[model samples]
Structure formats: structure tokens, C-alpha cells
Target: MPLLPGAEPYRHEGNEVGVLLCHGFTGSPQSMRPWGQYLAAQGLTVSVPLLPGHGTRWEDMQLTGWQDWYAEVDRKLTALTDRCERVFVCGLSMGGALALRLAAKHGEAVSGIAVVNPANKMHGIAVNALPVARHLIRTTKGVAGDIVKPGVKEVGYDRVPLHAADSLRRFLRLLDGELPQVTQPLLLMHSTVDHVVPPTDSARILGRVSSTDVREVLLEQSYHVATLDHDADRIFEESFAFFARLAPSVGKEGTATGG
Candidate 1:
């Protein structure tokens, strides 16, 4: 699908330390561009690929599923990993799930992973309906831009695609089962008042992952799309600090020694 203007994929060349950012389901790379740029400004190589079914008309998304989405990110991440001596990943919502799965498959090859309001499991009985309802329903109200800060907006599909969401559930379940295999450092941040994905999903991930170094922070001022909300700067800075602790060389000027 052709990308909309201003919704194109973004890439910036920097040091051998690369950071791959993934946007959530139905969200275009626009949602993650700011974060990628922030990291790039810090002299880190960064890329945010528009997922297979995203950055175009909503109807176009109906033809794709989780595999297509994950493949795009996996390809970008592995490419970064192969080229860089150190690599980190960041994602929002379902993007977080993708990051976790990469950690499971790539192991310590991923230096660390940072995510905000990631969804692995949804709350309430509404989830049970996904199996049967996906066949009967085409779309539902989307969970996009669930930000508490007024006037802020997130770029995503207006309605949730049933088939794609169903595929996400299955993919998330698969990732959840493999969470124990994710031993890389993890930094998870969740909003206190998110209306889309609940806090339980974040808790569940912390409970399941075997990572020895784990940090969970509460975003008291923002909502689900905190990456674009009032606390956006905080998320970026904290994430940079998290990476700095692991890769101290990142903070110094001209740290790029080719891997």
C-alpha cells in the first residue's frame, strides 16, 4: 500500500548502536517518528518501519495479519542487530509485544527493550468474543489516541479490524508463552489511567518474563498514547537513561567505532 504523505517510514544514520522502534497495531510510523528522531538526535542509529497493513487506508489493512506485521519488524531488527555491535528496541502497545518476541528469539543479542502501555492480554469478557465475533463483525470502535492530554492525537485506523485484531490475540498468546525465554533487560512503563489496554497486561508480562534486570514505572499524568501525550518527553528521556546505563559509551561524543 502507498503511504500517505507525512506517514512514510523514517531512518537516521548514527553510531553502530542501533535502536529499532515499532508502532502499535493500525498505527503508522508517524506515531513513532518523534521517539526515533529523539534517539537519532542523541547520535544513535534509528529506524521506524511502517508495518505491512499500516499507514494507508483502513480497508487495506484487512488483507494483512500479525505475521505480516511481525515479519516487517523482525526483518528490520535483525538487520540492525547484524550490523550494530549493540542494539536496543522500543515499541508502543502491540509494538511492545513484537519487541518481546524478538527478545525471546534473539536472546541477549537485543541489548534491551523499552515499551509503553504494551498489550499482551485485554481485560474483561470482551476478549472471549474475539474468536466468534471476528467472523461476524468487520470492525469496532478503535482504541486509537486514548490520551488523557487534550488536543493530542495519534495516527491510526478509526475502526479496529476484526481479523487483524484476532490475529493479534493469537500472536500475543504465542509471545506470552515464550516470555520466559526473554532474559534481556526490560524497561516497561504504563499509564495509570489508560482506557484502551489495561495495566494488567503489563503486570502479566513482568510476572512471566525471566529477565533479571526489570524496571516498571508508572506514568501518572498521561494515558495509553503517552508517547504523544503530555509526558512524551519524560518517556523519551527515561528511555535514553535506561539505554545509557547499559551502554555508557552512547552518551559520549563520537562514540561510533564501526562494529
Candidate 2:
């Protein structure tokens, strides 16, 4: 499938500490490109893969589900692991769930993790209908481009696919059960007020995960898409510092060595 312009995946070559960046559900890699470019500019290897069923059209995403989306990130993580001595994973919203899953399954293989408004569980009475809705309704309102930054746009589908959403719940259920296994250093960045995902999602993760090294930062200016909003610079700088402290080390020619 041909991708929309600026929605294509991106990769930047750098040192041995590789970072795999995942975009949110219904959101394309375009939302993460600026951040990836910023990290890449620092001579750190970076990848932002376009998840399956996204970056094209809404119907295309309806045909794909969580597993298809996850398979793509897993493949990218595998590639990064092979090339770098240490790897870190970060994601937005649903992508955050995928990052945690990677850390849980890969264990010590993943050096650490950072997430922006990670969504693992849904709230409100609307979620009670997801199972039945998936069989009846095709889609509903979308949670995209929720940035407070005026004029900034996140290329994504305007409608949320119910079938795909059901898959998301299944993936989250599996992930929530395995959260205790995630013991890597974690940094959670979230907005103070979000219209889409509530703060409880992050609280759930913080409480469930067994990671000893964990910190949370509240984003005061940004909304759900904090990566492109006003606090974006903070996200970039903080996550870079987070990665720097854990990354093995950079040798001559910017290659990574023992930390």
C-alpha cells in the first residue's frame, strides 16, 4: 500500500544504543519524526516504523489489528537488538503498550523504556460496549492529533475502528497481566489533562510494573499528543538524557561500546 506523503517510516544511523520508536494507534510515524530526527541528530540510532493498517487510509486500518501492528515493531526491535549493544523502546498511547510488552518479553535485552501518555486500559461506560460494538459498529470518533500546539497536525485516521479497538483491548489485557515482568528503567511522560486517555492509565502501569527505576513527569502544556505539542522539547531533552544515562557508551565514530 502506498503511504501518504510524510507518513512513511524513518530510520537514522548512529551509535550502538538503538531506540525503537512506535507511533500511536491510528497515528502515523509523522507524529514521531521530529523527535526521532532530534535523537538521530545526537548520533543515536533511531527508528520510527509505520504500524500496520496505518499511514494510508482509515479502511486499511480497519482491516488490520493489534497483532499486525505489534509484529512490525517486534521486527524492528529485533533488527535494532542485532545491531546495537543495548536497545531502548518508546511509544505514544497504544505504542506505549507495545513498548512495555517488548520490555516484558525481552527482559534484560531491553536496556530501558520511555513513553508519552501510554494507554493500556480504557475507562468510562463506553468501554463496556466494545465487545458488542466490534461486531456491530464499524467505527466511532477518533482520538488523533490531540495536540495543544496550534496548527500542528498528526497524520492519522479520523475514525476509530471497533474491530481494531477490540484487538487493542485483548493486547492490553495480555500486557497488563505481564506488567510485573517488566523490570527495566521506565520514564512516563503524560499531560496534566488529556481528553482521550485518562491519567489512570499511567497510574495503572506505575502500580503494576515491578521496575525499581521508575519516574513520572506531568506535562502541563501539552494534551494527548505531547510529542508535538508545547512540551515536546522537554520530552526530547529528558528522554535523550534518560537514554544517555543507560546507553552502553559511544566510542570513536559515534559507535557504542561498553558502558
Candidate 3:
């Protein structure tokens, strides 16, 4: 299948410290490319994998679910751990949930994590309707391009596959239980005026996670997709600094370094 423009995954093997980035639901790597490139330029090995059923058509997304999406990042994380002494996972929106899942599952293997507008649960009637809606409808309006910056658009499907969305709901529920398992340092950034996800999502995560090293940055000028919005540079710079501070230094042997 041909990928949409700007939907291609990104990878940069720069140093011993690795960062894995995950995009939002219905969003492609395009939403995360610039952030990944920025980190890569700062000498961190970065991987932004195109999740399965994403970067294609909405119909393709119906064929996949949260498990498929999480598996892709899970596999990528393992690959990074094999090559780098320390690895950090970062994600936006649903990707944030996936990143948290990785940190929960891997524990100390993940040095730390950073998330932008991370989502944990759905709000309003849609949450209740999703169970029945997935079977009755094929797709619904997509939550994309919620940016304050003019002329900037996120690369994602115009429609949200209902089946996939229902799966995401289930995934978030599972993630809530796993939040306490995320003990690594966490850097969370959220847009104060996000149109898609509410600020409460970030607050819920902070309250649930076991991580003592937690930092929160508020984006006043951006929306949901802050990574691609007005606060893009701030997100890039701060996250890089967060990972750098947590990453371990190379030892004399260099092969087996401290993390």
C-alpha cells in the first residue's frame, strides 16, 4: 500500500542513547518526524515506526486494533535496547498510552519517558456509545489537525474507524491499570487549550504513575497536536534535555555502559 505524503516512518542511529516515538491514533509518523529529527540531530538514536494499519486508508485501520499498534512499538523498543545502553519511549495522544505501556512492561529497561498530550480515557457519550457504535458504523469524524498554528496540518485519516476506536478504548482501560508500573522518570507536556484531549488526562496520569521524577510543561499557545503546533520547538528541546539528563554515560569498555 502506498503511504500518504509525510507518513513515512523515521529512524536515526546516532548514539548509545535511543528514543522511540509513537504517534496518535489515526495519525502517522508525519506528526512526529520533526521531533524525531530534532532528537536525532542532538545525537540520540531515534525510531518513529509507522504503526500497523496507519499511514494508509481508514478501511485498513479497521483491520487492525490496539494490540497491533502496541506490538509495532514493542518490537521497535526491543530493537533499540539491543543496540543502545539506555532507551526512552515518547508518544503523542494514543502513542502516549503505548509509550507508557512500554515503560510499564520493560520497567528499568526504559531509562525514562516523555509524552505530549497523552490520552488515557475517553470522555462524554462517545465512551459509552463506542461499544455499540463500532458494530453499527464503519467510521466517524477524525480528531486530527488540532493545532493553533495557521496552515499547519497533521497527516492522518479524515475518518476514524469505529472498530479501531473501540479497541483504543479498551487499550486505555488496560493502560490505566498499568500506570502504577511506570516507575521511570516521566516528562509530560500538555496543551492548555487542546481541542481534542482534555487537560484532565495528563493530570490523571500524573496521579496514577509511580514515577517520582515527573515534570509537566504547559503549552499555552498550542492545541492537541502540540508537537506540530506553536510550541513544537519547546517540546523538542525540553524532551531532548529530559532524555539527556536520564541517559547513562558510556563506561571505559563502551560495550557495556552504565544506564
Which candidate number has the best lDDT?
Answer: 3
lDDT of each: 0.87, 0.89, 0.91
Q: How would you encode candidate 2's per-residue C-alpha lDDT over 1-259 as one tens digit per residue?
A: 7898889999987888899999998999998999998888777889999998998888898898888998999999999999888899999999899999999999988999999999978766888799998889999888898888889988898998988888888888889999999999999999989988888899999999999999899999999999999999999998988887886473236453322
Put the candidates in lDDT order, highest first: 3, 2, 1
| Candidate 3 lDDT over residue span 1-259, tens digit each | 8999999999987778888999999999999999998877677788999999999899999999999999999999999999988899999999999999999999888999999999989877777899998999899998988988999999999999999999999999999999999999999999999878899999999999999999999999899999999899999999977876776452213432222
Q: Give the total clashing residue pairs for model 2.
A: 0
Clashes of each: 0, 0, 0
Identify the runs in model 2 with alpha carbons over 4 angstroms from their true place.
248-259
lDDT of 1 at 258: 28
lDDT of 1 by residue, 32-97 (tens): 888888988888889899898788877788789999998999999988988778999889999999
The candidate with the higher lDDT, 2 or 3, is 3
Question: Candidate 2 at 64: error in angstroms?
Answer: 1.3
Q: List the residue pairs that clash in candidate 2.
A: none
